[model samples]
Target: MSRAEPKTRPSDPRFSSGPAAKRPGWSAKSLELPSLGRSHRAPLARGRIAHAIELTRTLLEIPADYRIAIVPGSDTGAVEMAMWSLLGPRGVDVLAWEHFGGLWIKDIVDQLRLEDVRVLVGAGDIRHRLTMVDWQRDVVFTWNGTATGTCVPGADWIEYDRQGLAICDATSAIFGEPIPVSKLDVIAFSWQKCLGGEAAHGVLVLSPKAVERLLSYTPPWPMPKLFRMKDSAGLLPGLFSGNTINTVSLLCVEDAIDSMEWAISIGGLSALHQRVRDNYQVVADWVAASPWADFLEAVEPCRSRTSVCLRISDPKIAGLDVAGQHRFTSEIAQRLDNMGAAFDISGFRTAPPSLRIWCGPTVETNNLKALMPWLDWAFAEQELHLHQHS
Candidate 1:
């Protein structure tokens, strides 16, 4: 038996899709000294959070009227806070393309037990035909479906004058893409993903309308202390400003600020978008040249420029039964990991058997180019193994 070849390069291009690659030269230690284990209610923690919110506004160009808050629980918490607070006042239309959107729909219809829910689901990959439903009702959607590597092209699909709220889960798309703030009422994201910070905290951005709804509407059910946005029949201004119900790590806050500053210094959102687009191009070129691979997305325009999902086209590999195809792809992914050429290139468990790659801003295009050869090598190794077995 021979030992696998050791990787000569950094394994940072692992690209598992979430908790994405951090911005270059980013370090949590760069922030002032403070133990994150301490209570986040401390003055120092509050200041750190305030700074993060300010930077988020600057980087994303959020409207001055809109308020940004560092809330608990990742993007899920932020979105749910918006949902629980605002959904009771109006009907909701949930647009689901992939798993995350599906989860949001489930929460609205099942967990929240909302009776009037309209859902629009597309076929094939999330890039399929998008049927427009009534926008007069509250609309909930993920701006980018991280799992399927698909995204709606801005808020063009939304009707701005409609008497409804637009709630967006932009965990993976925020900062990396262009989002029309005017079209969005409530937006939610986590510190992870495009921001590349720690995973425990969520950021909620509330438009004027969203705030009004929170202040006016009374949810039919009791709300948890953490989820409760309206207490004493008014929106908690402190919750939107700083000092959330629970303490958040000051270090994470500092890291998030650093990431935001980096985004601003490097031409803000435009630079961030260019970086992601460059990364996707690297993968696209690889897919075009490789005989054994192609993107899962049917059309080029609908494909995701952030999370690039690919399918192996080799007949020798695809010729296998469904189970065999899975095993073969799994073996290739494992081999790449064992060699340290990549770490988490395996397709999402819920999605079809296809390779998902992260092409976010933090990922180096050169690194992706270098990794493509390794992927080819890994697949070739798999073919050799299959030949031997046969």
Candidate 2:
């Protein structure tokens, strides 16, 4: 028998991993006070920028010595800037377990064409490979595998006295995971991620060591004006404050401030982390109960609490070949979408067939519980549809 559709729907269904679900009650009216038309150099506009950085530091409990700047582009821009400026000083090690990680490796090898670079990969057991790497080489990696839903268990894997810099692309892990700032040299994330702020700009947090490296070493390659962080005098200190290298949408800035304010009100990072923990627990409980569903990342410690990807192992879906599996997975996601039970829960375009649900802080645990029944209904309906059509 086909299962009946779920009667209760999630109150808010904006669950795309990037530009994720907005804070509860977020609306366009939140931008009313922004310095929209004013010059960013003006005191009012600059103060807004400074406030955003400061609140983010407070919420994230960032160390005082670290510099946080609003940079051009999103997380990609911040990561690339760090790579372009700090990589050539020594040999670099790039690590990958998913799509974003692969892109950084390509940048180091294909784009920069760096001779002394090593790429380590595996969706599971990457920590073992990381243990074997020469820490003397500058290392680049993502804090979370957004596509694969795996993350480094913790910063304990890092060598405390390593000579080279650790540049991490922490776009998805920033608010959702605990990152040891003392161990990371350079970390970058966008406001549009777990915070659920608007996109088109990013925040780059640089440790004092990273700043020192930027000031002392200049890359041999041509640095575009957008990527350059230094001048003849050395690292541009102004950028670390409120001065931006390029124009940003003040509307987005206001939205970021609004989100940061919301974060602080909810007891800051601890509250946010608890919210995500609760959200993930709801799905984890469901997955434990459902014989047909399993996590894409089997390693519990490495699983991402933010982008939760799952594979269907039920005989109905698992027996299908790769192409058939893809179709079946898409059908399930589409059915859920058409029913207004979920949105953007499809796995990444490049990843294997699965469902990638956003379990970030912005999402309420109750909503996830509500959505789970819809997921079960969708899968059943999809199987029935396949049977009738075929």
Candidate 3:
């Protein structure tokens, strides 16, 4: 039997994980461009960058003692900077739950070749291994797995008075979820993720401990100019004060500021969290009734609200081999994209076959509610086609 076209389509179809949907009512005209052509070092441009940093601090509720800097590379660059600058000082415990976390592990073992490293790995749910990690060693993990949509419930598992650092890659979780800033030593995220701003830039937040590590220890490997955060005279004075290590896009700065301002106007962090919660609930409810799909993260607490990844549950699709599953899911995603009901909702290239939806604050709950039916429609359509051909 053929499933009918969805009676309603999502008002806006963008659902990409990164470079995700823009904030509601967002437009290019909404961005302030006075600093567009100006040099990054210019007063106007520098001021905008500084404002963006401050806005990030305010919205995310980062502690005053923590320093925030706008770095050259997006979240990837920021995480690399942290690992390069601090990991040599002590043994580290790294988690390899998803794409980015796995990469961090590779960097720690293969690239850095760190001798004393403990890698704790898991698939959809990694909570059990949390108890296995020794807090005495520096810990590297993603607060939320962007690819798998699994997240640690909270920071309570972290040792408050541990001897080592807690470095986190929180690109997709920053504004979209609540983060405990005090427990983290090095936190990295990109403007393009939760803020729905443009790419090519990352925000690095450092606890006082992270700064002390930077000032005290230097990695044995060469540090690139882009990753260098300090100099001979203590830390770089201007680096955190909007004096970026390299040239930055002034236009992107304005866009980040615009997003932050929008976030602030809409009741700040709590409001953003509420928006994410509501949006996730809409998808969760749909999945609860979905005969063919369910979230990859089975544990409710561990499931990420921002990146909601769903796996196919239908017998025909689930029984397929890895490559077959990939091809099937990719085809469905392409069909949805072509139908103009959704776009970029496919699973991460490195992840298992699944549908990853962005339920960040920028994405509207109404749109997600509308999108649920379309998802069912697409899945059923694919099933019908399979039945006829096979």
Best-fitting candidate, scored by TM-score: 3
* Clashing residue pairs for model 3: none
Using lDDT as the yardstick, the better of models 1 and 2 is 2
Query: Where is model 3 more than 4 Å wrong at Cα?
Result: none
lDDT of 3 by residue, 1-390 (tens): 778888888899998888988899999999989898888999988898999999988999988999999998899999998999899878999987788898999999999999999999955457788988888899999999978888988988998998999999999999988888898999999988888889999999999988888988878898888888888888887999899999998888898999999999999999999999999999988988889998887889999999999999888899989897887888889888998989999999988889999999999889999888888888888877777888
* Cα deviation of 161, candidate 3, in Å: 0.4
Model 3 residue 355 CA deviation (Å) reads 0.6
Best by lDDT: 3
Q: What is the lDDT of residue 52 in candidate 3?
A: 90
Identify the runs in model 2 with alpha carbons over 4 angstroms from their true place.
none
Cα lDDT tens digits, model 2, 1-390, are 789777899887767898899998888886657588999888989988888889888988999999999999899999998898888878988888899999999899998999999888864666787786678999999999889898888888898898999999999989888888889999999988899988889899999989888888878899989897778887676888788899877888889989889988988898888988999999999999987889998889888999999999898789889888888888888888888888988889888889999999998788898999988998888888888988
What is the TM-score (0 to 1) of candidate 3? 0.98
**Residue pair clashes in candidate 2:** none
